[model samples]
Target: MPGSVIGINMNYGYPGQASRHGDEVSRTRPVATTSEKIMFGAPVVQNTDGSVKAWEAASTAANFAGVAMRKVKAAKIYPYQNFGYYGAGEPCDVLLRGGISVVCAWGTPTIGGTVYVRTNVAEEGSPEEAKIGDFGAEDESGNCIALTNAKWSSSKDERNVAELTILTRQGV
Candidate 1:
């Protein structure tokens, strides 16, 4: 007798992907000239002039705009190329209020748990040091700050990606 083989589906969705449709509200904003590369699903804040930049500190949490959304680009020849990020001066679609998939940089995600963004305080020599835009469930060594109106919609999957639902933003 011949052995049978089974196939498995390993399709974890990409970051910044909206879990559902209709209720999502997104706005196009220009990436600030001084902003770093804004990855899809990274938390961002708006400059006084309305340009968007990656979240850098707790003080700017009040200016929290939302997560950078991933838009399909014709130049990306492969599905996994670049891991999806927008360069300075690019037009970025930001999800203001909705369920979005994001990368969990540290800590485990649980449904209904508060969403925290890693700030610049993450220890300079730690793995999270360069994870400024990633999400977490707790303030790791005071390096993360909670997004007041956002929560985890789903636990992180094998790909370290989870669904986050932003209910409201301060100025959105």
Candidate 2:
């Protein structure tokens, strides 16, 4: 019999289940109006109407909400939560500070190094060109994606796994 790997998990833990590291509480938010598609691991913010949208460089720190725990389409239901397998794509259950994510490399990512949210994050590419600290902090000091492990890379074709512990001044 040939050996086979079941699934690809750079890290461990379900969306709501407790992991060895610890259990992180997830909160639900409403989806905001946006043309951009929502994906897992991407940072997000709160709109004036209390809806959640993707977090970008222009997004201010005070408005910093959390990372999208699932894929949210435009014009969906309110109060989203991760209810799928590992919570890949569900809705609003955004993971704010203290949540860990196994993010795909959109740039050359390194362990313990910081990564930023990109609207155009490539499937696999060198993040060297990616801007650092684009999270729109009060000082414009960008929110940082702190890596829990070192999976550094410089190739754009290679898929790099980055474990991120989102670190920002603002919290949910």
Candidate 3:
């Protein structure tokens, strides 16, 4: 999540696929709206020696949100809204994921709240694609939270443990 992905999105920015409020075309931008949401920008490419080097997006996509475009950020979010989907549903809970540090309070997560976590995300879109967005409300109170406090276990201790684990539906 520290780095950025730049590429042409197949879901959006096309002729035949151009339709307002349509999922047929996805948008391409710095994907940050959805937690754990991963999107690969165009492959990084190398120009020297005809090698493909990594390249980030040279431009930004515009959201058609009725709200003042001023509020629309140069970010990866819904096409027509100020706040992008919290992605606080189903598998996208950032706190309960395995790598999240146990310090986070996972019980009773509100609609759009962030719980302190220490989980390592996948290379780019691996975990995001696997993380099915959710749209339910939970109360993060005195409950048995599923904080998989597993320290970084990658060969480089990269904290990729959560990548291999599929989070349960929901828990505190």
Clashing pairs in 1: none
Clash counts for all predictions: 0, 8, 22
Worst 10 residues of 1 by lDDT: 3-12
Give lDDT tens digits, candidate 1, residues 1-172. 4343552645337888887676799998899999888888888888888888877765445777888888886554466643678889999889999888888877788889988877765346446345666688766666667788888988787788888898985564
Give all TM-scores, in the order shown. Answer: 0.84, 0.51, 0.15
Best by lDDT: 1
lDDT per residue, candidate 3, 1-172, as tens digits? 4343653322222111112232121212222322242212111112223222121222111111001001223455546332232221211112212222111112233212332121222355322322211111122222111122212111111221111111221222
Please give the CA lDDT of all the candidate structures. Answer: 0.78, 0.43, 0.20
Query: What tens-digit string does per-residue lDDT give for candidate 2 at 83-144?
Result: 23222133466665554444443445444444444333333442455543222111112234
lDDT of 2 at 4: 48
The predicted structure with the larger TM-score, 1 or 2, is: 1
Q: If both were scored by lDDT, which would come out higher, candidate 1 or candidate 2?
A: 1
Instruction: Sort every candidate by lDDT, greatest first.
Output: 1, 2, 3
Determine which window of 10 residues in candidate 3 has minimal summed lDDT. 60-69
Q: Report the lDDT of model 1 for residue 144.
A: 66
